[model samples]
Target: QGVVDPLGGINTLWPLFGIGNQMLASMALILGTVVLFKMKKQRYAWVTILPTVWLFITSMTAGWQKIFHEKPSIGFLAQANKFRKGLDEGVIIAPAKSVADMQTIVFSNQINAALCAFFMLVAVTMLISAFFVIRRALRSDLPTTHESVVTLRNKEVRHV
Candidate 1:
């Protein structure tokens, strides 16, 4: 590796990132509903609150490396050094390398991750609030017969 090419990690794991992102988004949708359906407000609050803290920690750890100009892992660093030495000896063909390029790539990914966390937090909060609102509306005194009635549309009658 040289001091000119960056984004080695991105080049390797971009596909995996896309797949993982899609899975996480789906999980959030399901988990958000689980929190929303809790009859107790405290349960709903706790469900959303804990994950927010977890995300904060994850974001910080992932983002901190970029902020501090740290390498990915000890093994990765060792391998990169070996690769660079091989390239210098004309035994391997590798692109130029730059720490700045790596940091920029990490920063972009961290930003995307933070945004995803923010969206999940927002969705969970909205679900909690919506549940409370609906629960309150349901609790209001009303005629039981009127509340129990189910109206069918013309399309539904045709299907029947």
Candidate 2:
């Protein structure tokens, strides 16, 4: 018999997980450049390409949080100060800063949340598209279609 599947779950999830996240990003860069060179249907390519840029920016901000131990932005000082106050009543005085800094931290958090939501939407869409493509491929039978009497395309032939 044929070889048993070595990666059952991965084979199923690869397109949705792999392509929708990492592979799509790489493809976006390559395909975007190719589309620009070909001068073809660029609108579709831009839709895929723009998200990679957003992902890059978001990853930069989020990655810093994961990689380093740093104080919150000045905008978040109020919340940070609030926590510090609770920790030691006599210590950890809040830094003097403009209200704008607090607003900036709050705004950054909001921006971060919004970016995550948008990327999730993109991933879902990519998953659906992948499913449809796989479904079509599974349903298609070129071997049988060639034997059929009906023509798939009806364009008139032009002989040079």
Candidate 3:
């Protein structure tokens, strides 16, 4: 029987994917809250607002940890730096059997770090925009974009 490493493959990619997914979810919730406010249903906005706040906090914290944590297995930038230093010193690491492998690992980790940073930036931007929209909605300064209700009278109703 062969030993199976549960996180042997795709471990690095999974965290990035998860962070992106959560960020998108957070944005959707924020948008939902803004729409509720725009419709002048401020009391019902908490349904989306609460989840938005929670997801934002969780996702941002995860992203930050992935980018800045000291552990190579946990942080993309840290892993990249570790491999880079190994390459600079002409040392071949266990996970990296060759110099080319080390270079590739370093590049991949850097790309992952950049992607995490970009996701965080987009999430922050969306949150800021939603904040302003909700504020304007509360002040009645923003017009509702939802279509107005049109009542159909008996005379206006026609059989298809």
Clashes of each: 4, 2, 0
| Highest lDDT against the true fold, candidate | 3
Ranking by lDDT: 3, 1, 2
lDDT (tens digit, per residue) of candidate 1 on 1-160: 2222254555435523543454355446435534343333334555554664465345434333322333433223333444455555655333434444444444444444454445446545655665675465456554112212345873333211
TM-score for predicted model 3 compared with the true structure:
0.84
For model 1, the stretches where C-alpha displacement exceeds 4 angstroms are 1-96, 141-160
Q: Give the residue spans of candidate 3 off by over 4 A.
A: 1-9, 141-143, 147-160
Candidate 3 lDDT (Cα, whole model)? 0.82
Give TM per candidate.
0.34, 0.35, 0.84
- lDDT, candidate 2, at 23: 36
Give model 2's TM-score versus the native structure: 0.35
> Compared with the true structure, what per-residue lDDT tens digits does model 3 show for residues 35-143?
8888787898889988888999999999999999999989988988988999999998767778877877787778778989999999999999988988888888554
Best-to-worst ranking by TM-score: 3, 2, 1
Task: Please give the distance, in angstroms, between residue 91's alpha carbon in candidate 2 and its true position after superposition.
Answer: 14
